[model samples]
Target: MQLAVLGSPIGQALSPVLHRAAFQALGLDWTYHAIDCTPDRLASFLGELDDTWAGLSLTMPLKQSVVPLLDRASDTVVRTGAANTIVVSDGQLIGENTDLYGMTQALSDAGVTTACGVTVLGAGATACTALAAAHELGCDRATVIARNAGRARQFLGPAAERIGVKVRITPWTTAPAHLEAELVISALPPGAADELAPLWKPAAGTLMDVLYRPWPTPLAQAAATAGRRVIGGLPMLVHQAARQVELQTKCPRPPYEDMLTAASAAVHQLDTTT
Candidate 1:
């Protein structure tokens, strides 16, 4: 079987390593690759896939873009309006948003069981997943910090209402006072939150930065220096990809530890090379 991760600038993705490790451990002769696909050309790309294609792991611009093209979507995808995992079963496409579980499991692994006040950085599709994860972790209210207040509110307001999390949208230029929360999930890209990192003065709790390629992101470093519990995105990536493996291969249980080891090694290698 064949599987792949689809996104622009997808060369840096560790998904192939993780999934290949899972297949090796499970004795499955499957191949996975990374493909550069954008929103405009996604339809053409999907049309070219043959029966050997088992699944596609989406990232960045393709997550929301692939939603309308799927035959069916999961509740998480419907709730977040994003699809990260597409399984091809009997030539039918099924979309699922495993990112909800991904973020929540990453938080739980970092010693966060439940949270009250939450602050999420940015207001993109990943931010939506963060909000859903926070709600699942018992966060009743949240404050989203973004640059475009209008766009942020327009996208997050209804999502907050749907998820039952009272949300307060704050502009990035404003002070970072609203950042004081039990948990802060940074959905922004690397170096995007550097300005707020030094100014962040949260009294306590964890900060899970959803970026692992660069090792200690500026935001993550600042949070750690401030004595906050810090966790990277690798844990979440591993868990979500493991779920995708199960969904694609019909494996009741994939080799999670093997994937984790492979992902850790890949990240370590990247850190060393950089």
Candidate 2:
């Protein structure tokens, strides 16, 4: 069966590598590819596909746009209004959001305690996922910082209401305060995050940078130097992709180690290519 990940700037995605490795380990005959599809061209892109496509992984601008195109979706997808995984069954498209599962699992695996505070950077779709994840992780108080305050407030309002977390929205120019929370999740893009490093520091708890590429982002490096625990975005990426594989292939559990190794190798290859 054929499966693929779709996004505008999708060439950098490690999904194909991880999914291919899982398929190989499970002895499943499946091929996965990444396609660069922007929001304007998404309709035409979907029109070209047929039933032979087993599944699709949506990213960036398409995550929200693809929702209307799906025949059905899980409750979480409806709640989040976004989809990262699309399962094709008998020509029907079923959308699901595995990003929350991935982010939640990563926080749990990192031993982040319940009822803690969380500070998240960015107000995009991934940041929304992080907000949901923080709530699921038992974070009662959360703050979302974005380059644009209006956009941040808009994206965070519904999620904060649904999750019942005290959500605060602020401009990215304001430095994040080290409050009572023990975890800080950087959900910003790589370039933007690099610029924000000088203004932020992880105090007493773990700092999770949601960028896997470039290995350790500047924020992570700064946090590490400040004697704070650090978690990379790779764990979330692997876990989320694993959940997608399970949903698409009906596998009981994902081959985690194999996927991680493959993702690492793929990143290494990318580094060499550049």
Candidate 3:
């Protein structure tokens, strides 16, 4: 069996590491790879593939673009208006969103029992998933801070409306001061987090960064230094990949320790390559 994570500039993806580890631990002869697929090339790529492709992990530009190309999608995919995982059965592609699963799992693992006010940075695809996660956690009020305020609203406004959560969009510079919340989720890219680090005050709540590649992100480090609980994005990646493996192979749960070891090794290899 074969599977792959498809995205543009996918060199940094850890999917292969986790999936391969799970397959190896389970003694399955499955292969997982990453394809650097741009949006313009997606259709031709999908058309070229046959039933040999067991599943696919979509990221970035492909997530929203591939939704219309899928034969069908789960309710979660429809609601999120994005596709992260696709399973092919009988030559038909079915789309699902494991991003939400990842976000929710990360929050739960951090012991965020009840959703309080949330300030989320970035309003891209990942931010949409974060909003969905916040709603699932019962967060009624949310403030979305984005470089492009309109884009942030475009990304999160509909989902917030559907989920009955009050969401407001604001420029990152004008984000409210003296903010109080039980949880703060940073969806910004790695470098962006560094700039936002100073603006971040040490709230007595959990601070979660969706970027895990660099390990302790600047925001996470600041939060840690301030004695705040922080959750890295690696746990979310692992848990979400576990759900994807279960969906694809009906495995109980991906062997997390093995997956983590493989992922850590992959990260080290990535560091060396860079």
Candidate 4:
């Protein structure tokens, strides 16, 4: 069978390393690869897949875009309006979102139990998952920061309701002087949160920056400097991919250490070069 992660500028993705390791460990004769799939090209690419194609991991621009292409989506997808995993079964494409689980696992691993208030930076597809994850972590209220207030409000409105969290919107440029949430989730792309890093001061809690590459992102570094517990996105990425593997292969318990080891090696290689 075949599986791959699809995204733009996907060459740097460590998904291949992780998946290949998992397949080898499980003795599965499966092949995993990465394909540069831009938003405009996703449809053409989907059309060419055959039975051998098992599943796909969508990233960035394609997460929300792939919604319409699916025969059906999981509850997470319906609520978040985004999907990261698509399983091709019997000529039907089924969409799902393992991100929420991944995010929850990451936060739990970082020692976050129950959050009364959650603050999320950036209002994109991933931010939707962040909101859902916050709710899963027992957060009653969520404050989302986005450049465009109208767009943020519209998108986060239903998502917040579905997650059972009261919603509040904040302009990106006018972030509050004191962000005192029990947990702060930075869902912005690489480097996007750097400039605002200094402005963030949490009375207590952890900071999770959803960007793993380049090792210490400025935001993460700043958070660390402030003596806050910091979690990078790699653990979340690994966990989510493991869920995808379980779904596609029907292996309830896929060996995850192999994947984490592979991912760590790739991160080490990147670290040495930088």
Each model's C-alpha lDDT?
0.88, 0.83, 0.82, 0.86
Per-residue lDDT tens digits for candidate 1, residues 6-79, read 99989889999999999999999999999999999999888888899999999989998899999899988888
CA RMSD of all predictions: 1.3, 1.8, 1.7, 1.5
TM-scores, in order shown? Answer: 0.96, 0.93, 0.94, 0.95
Best by TM-score: 1
lDDT of 2 by residue, 1-274 (tens): 9999999898688999999999999999889999998989887877677978989999888988888888899877876778999998987889999998888888778886563778888887787787777878777778887789897777678867765678888777664464225777887887777765665443578888889989788878877877778889998999999999999999997898899999988888888899
Residue 128, model 2: lDDT of: 74
Sort order, TM-score high to low: 1, 4, 3, 2
**lDDT tens string, model 4, 85-188?**
99999988899999998888888887886788788998988999999998887777888888788999888888788767888888876666435566789988
Candidate 3 lDDT, 56-165, residue by residue in tens? 99988798899899999988887778889988888988999998888887778778867778888788878877878888888888888888988767767887787667
**Candidate 3 local Cα displacement, residue 84, angstroms:** 0.7
Lowest lDDT 10-residue stretch of candidate 4: 173-182
lDDT of 4 at 14: 85
lDDT of 4: 0.86
